[model samples]
Target: MPLCHLLQFVTSVVSCSPAELKLDNNGKKEKVKGFNVILKDTILFPEGGGQPDDHGTIEDLPVVRVLRQGAEAVHFISSALEEGREVQLKVDWERRFDHMQQHSGQHLITALADKMFGYKTTSWELGRQRSSIELDTASVKPGEMEALEDAVNNRIRDHVPVNVRLLSIDDPDVEKVRSRGLPDDHAGPIRIIDIEGIDTNMCCGTHVSNLSHLQVIKILGTEKGKKNKTNLIFIAGNRVLKYAEKSYNTEKLLTSLLKTGPDEHVDAVDKLQKTVKRLQKSNLTILRDMAVLIAQNFKSQPARGDFFSLHNKDGDNEFMNIIANEIGFQDTIIFLTVGEEKGAGLFLLAGPENVITELGPRVVELLQGKGAGKNGRFQGKANSLAKRAEVEALLQKHSCRRAAGEE
Candidate 1:
């Protein structure tokens, strides 16, 4: 039987000892305390060759991770089994098969891309949702993407056999195959994946024996990568079905909300976006006019208050600035707030330079905000507007004291 299918193995434990394993999860290095178990033989494939580690059980104890340390496949498990004791190993076939499909699909795409477009895959990733191959070219045209997809799917339908060969470094055939060089601590026979008449490449990742097992390959599309490179995204096997189901559900939801068919959904969304933009333009015009009128009314008041203050729930920093600009701060202190009545928002304070400088930090502390200012104007994001009344009182008290001092 092929080694990949040897999920059930009765092997003696070579060693089992307490150890701390550091693993990079989502760009974060995390330390896991476990026992490193080396078996006489292992079916679990360690993370390498752009493929992830296999998840399985070691004597019914869950193997958290498997890593290749030179020639040894070390298994990390929560508990330890006695050294030299024989134990049964089981592989999570579902996870293993998914990885196989993605890895093999990647090979098919990479090979065809190089053959058809002369775009060599510089690197590839088997992501959780989809896989991507970074092509050395600056861009891939839409027509080329379509043709590549057709070619890969054709190979899948052809039921081409995927053969694995173990060759020594000195073997003449090793020179014929595509290689990216071996690891620094590599040893023993080098494994090569041959896609019948399609291509042969040096790789250590597990693959499906037949191309037909891939079921289908869907080239989702491409995205701009680093300079002179493009990332071609794709999904294969069950992932294609899952993606289709999710997309259909989203379409149905959009259809219900949009009251239109899938074909008209894009047009409907575009029309709504244009309308929103027009309304936003009109709203801005109205806010500017209103800011001027508000200042005029405050100045025309029969008995003007000690300080002027206003809060607009639907306003923003620009609106507050417009109001402050209209109401000059020569002899008046203006406290303008734009946001929710008693929640987070923005605050603007403009008055004498010395007064604003003295009050800016205190206001920021009260509202749990951070801001900077020069001259006389101070503005910032206000996290808590619940203290707006207290801020107004402080401004009024200081204004009163300043007025008395001037008198």
Candidate 2:
């Protein structure tokens, strides 16, 4: 009746030749001769649908890359063997096996979500280490997601047979086949992968012969998407084992650093944080007591008219500021202190406002420092205690000049 139906009828009536071709390592057309066998007509689908291409060896030589030329898939060989000679094809059994596990796992996950939540998978991808299927729904609740993950994993453990069948698009059986999506230009016979009792889809990619091949399915996480969609990220098979091993190693390292076992490391961190806070409080209390003692000692000093000096190893900028403020109210007190550590010194000059303005520059010049301000108050650092008397003498001379109105 319809053109598609007529074409399907004709295709069903005739079997198309298998397109697998086995070539020699030298890229020559050949038959089964060496361990490497390139197929003339192959069911192996080169990487598409975000899933990588299959990797294997033909006649023992590795197939490094599989590419598409028009409608044909080409398997590139590694070693250059005899040209124009036929070789036996060998697919990398491990890689092919893993791909099958992940692909089948993806179908189970998508199908379960569609059946339970009405979330149809819009697109899907099989990554190297992980896979994801995007659903038409925007979001799924965490509890609902947990149920979906459990359902899919249960299916993997069910060990259903994964069947691959080629049928014409126009066949009457096509009406009974429900597919997520099929390649639009796949006009002749279509490759359908049926996960018995789970899913049926048009796919050219290799899959495990049975569901038992996928030992496990682990949903790692789900992320939100635009246009009312969600991306389901997951790992399966040997990938799950590898991920668990890595996590175990990381936990071991952390436990060693924390000096605690795996189960206690988190509690150890919390306890250590509280201990640090308590010690910090005790240290602050000691600093405050020291500040008060220093302030009192400065007050007991005899008020001097010319200048006075003190060297303090425990004094810092804040400590010096407190002491200076306490002693500054005196009529004439030029307090100086050498800080305990390197790169520290303090000078506090206070006298008649006019006298300080005149002598401050002279004092700063002698100490090899530079600063200026109003009033008979000047504060700064000296290079060393040896230069303190020299700076004090300069200040005294300037004060005398200001008193004599010669400044």
Candidate 3:
């Protein structure tokens, strides 16, 4: 039997080497320094065969990671242990049992998928939340998935015995077992996982002793995979309960917010979205009409000033453009801004081409903004609309200076 098959063991440290391990924190990569210790034997399984490494403790020190290197399992620990020292090794049983359930569940699903539907499992992953098996087929229909789930759960209810068998590499039984091939440095007897009357595959990951231990398996759904393949997502054992609880909580929150029953959530949200769209359209129409009125009123002034300026706190670039178009930029230097009076907003300057070219850069600087101009129209976003009075003074002073020069 493999030492990993045991949950607790007394072992001697063979060697210790200090090393730095790079880990992904969220989306960031970080490096952590630790000691890689090889033990005379280990109860913690190393990462291999598509299953993650087991986490445990050695003499009360945390064993963070384990990896199989040739015939040895290297345990990465937070602190170094003296070589040849005897230590007590204990596996994190909860995590170990979870892996056992998921690994065994995967075997059952893979075996039955091949047997019943002839869907060969090309690859599989034991993910943190859920596990998946990639089938050679392009897709799995809902009906087929339902049937597959039913079949796997039936076997779980059957309480079938799952046995581990060891055989010589050259044994006839070794050839009968399903295998993806052995690692380059594989040694000792071949380890085979046998699901009585169900499957016999060569795997090094831990597994449950009985099908009943899987508790249950839920086929979540299917997702697109590589060319001509489909990935079937699933959750087994306690994960099924976790997923259900999360889904129910989400449904409850939506029901409360939407003020509708769970069944009516979709329709209620759809109606709310349509109402918002309608209101936005109406608001845009009103803003356009108001812009035209403001322009006409400014034009109606009997004694018109060279510069006409207006600011609408709750307006946008389109609103300012509408006002400028209605007033006509031929004669008056129109400085229209739409946004907060003392905060961020947008501004448009339209008049003489020479004036636009000269004043555009100044206006952008005063407004703490960025803008572009062509012909006689300049427009851009403004970050400091509070400085509008200073911009007005500058425009007035420049206009007066130009008029006097013309005279």
Candidate 4:
């Protein structure tokens, strides 16, 4: 059987050397001047038991991954160590401790969730930023969530011992364990993690010696997961502090933008949205009336067989449609109306068939934009509004040439 690389059994000094590494895609050992080394044993836990492998350095080369194959633990590396030579191994203590705290906290939370609400954890993922466990239920109510959190935190604050006991399959203690069950293949020894006066469960993942190391457990939220399960997202230890800091910074930014304290931000945003909606309605009324006046002005002017233009920053497709339809209803005059609102530019042209045919492509080409229309009307979006002035100038010049030709 492969030796379990437990932190409790190994020290910083090891007699291991470059043991074995996986090959690259080309069916040969990578020549990238790196060693695939494993210790005679390791303090770094191989990825298993729903927890990730421990990250650290062996003989000064960074360990990429510690994977288990059959009965042996394999540690992939960035570079190789001398074969059969002694080396130093260092586990990233901060990372290890963080995993320990999270794994232990999960055990406590999972136990209490079952005991109090009968919600069994179906599965769990140990993530770097946040960890999550899927509970075997379709829905998790807010009150149930609060109760679970309170119960879990109550255990953590109690500073109870989290002891590990190794036992055979036939051990009486195995029956006492609150376990999902043993694997179908069956194993040699089962490592049972027992939380004092709480629960005992079979787990291979590392854990804190005590619950106080958990520091704190925060249930971020939950979502419906696969097969009608509820995925509970959580963070523990320093991660909770980091998450709190990020949330605080985001709220502070919202406070600045809304000009309100965090407590009043919702009300302020609601009022701001209502105010904006009213202003938009008022602006649309003014622009529609202006479009009417402009159409009348162009109608009152002497017929100029050239394209005229109107610009409105606040105009929309509907407003442009009203303006274009209003003026061209009476004369053979071709006009260009443009608006650049919210950094998007739009244009419309209508008039004599020849003018629309000639000017449409010229306008689109000038802006390097996209447009398509037929029967004396064409419009399209520009790549950007920055080139609107250049496109409009080209329209003016084209219209002048067409007028000259007509003369």
Off by over 4 Å in 2: 1-39, 78-83, 184-188, 266-407
Displacement of the residue 133 alpha carbon in candidate 4, Å: 2.9
Point out the worst 10-residue segment of candidate 2 by lDDT: 4-13
Residue-pair clashes per candidate: 0, 32, 0, 4
lDDT of 1 at 242: 92
- Candidate 2 per-residue C-alpha lDDT over 204-258 given as tens digits, one digit per residue, 9 for 90 to 100: 6666777677788888888986687899899988989988999899899988889
Instruction: Give all TM-scores, in the order shown.
Output: 0.87, 0.55, 0.74, 0.66
Segments in model 3 whose C-alpha atoms lie over 4 Å from true places: 1-5, 279-407
Q: Whole-model lDDT for model 2 versus the true structure?
A: 0.66
As a whole number from 0 to 100, the lDDT of residue 257 in candidate 3 is 96
True lDDT of residue 273, candidate 4: 95
- Model 4 TM-score relative to the real fold: 0.66
Per-model lDDT: 0.91, 0.66, 0.90, 0.75
lDDT per residue (tens digit) for residues 1-407 in model 3: 43435778998999999988877799798899999999998889999998988999999899888999999999988898999999999999888888888899999999999999999988899999999999999977669989999999999999999998889998999989998899899989999999999999999999988899899999999999999899999999988888899999999999989999999999999999999999999999999899989989988998887788888887888899888888887767889898888999899999888888899999999999999998889999999898999999988887787777862
Error of 3 at 49 (Å): 1.4
Cα lDDT tens digits for candidate 4, 166-212? 99888887887877766564546889888999988898888887888
TM-score of 1: 0.87
Error of 3 at 40 (Å): 1.2
lDDT of 3 at 383: 93
TM-score of 3: 0.74
| Candidate 4 displacement at residue 59 in angstroms | 6.3
lDDT, candidate 2, residue 170? 78
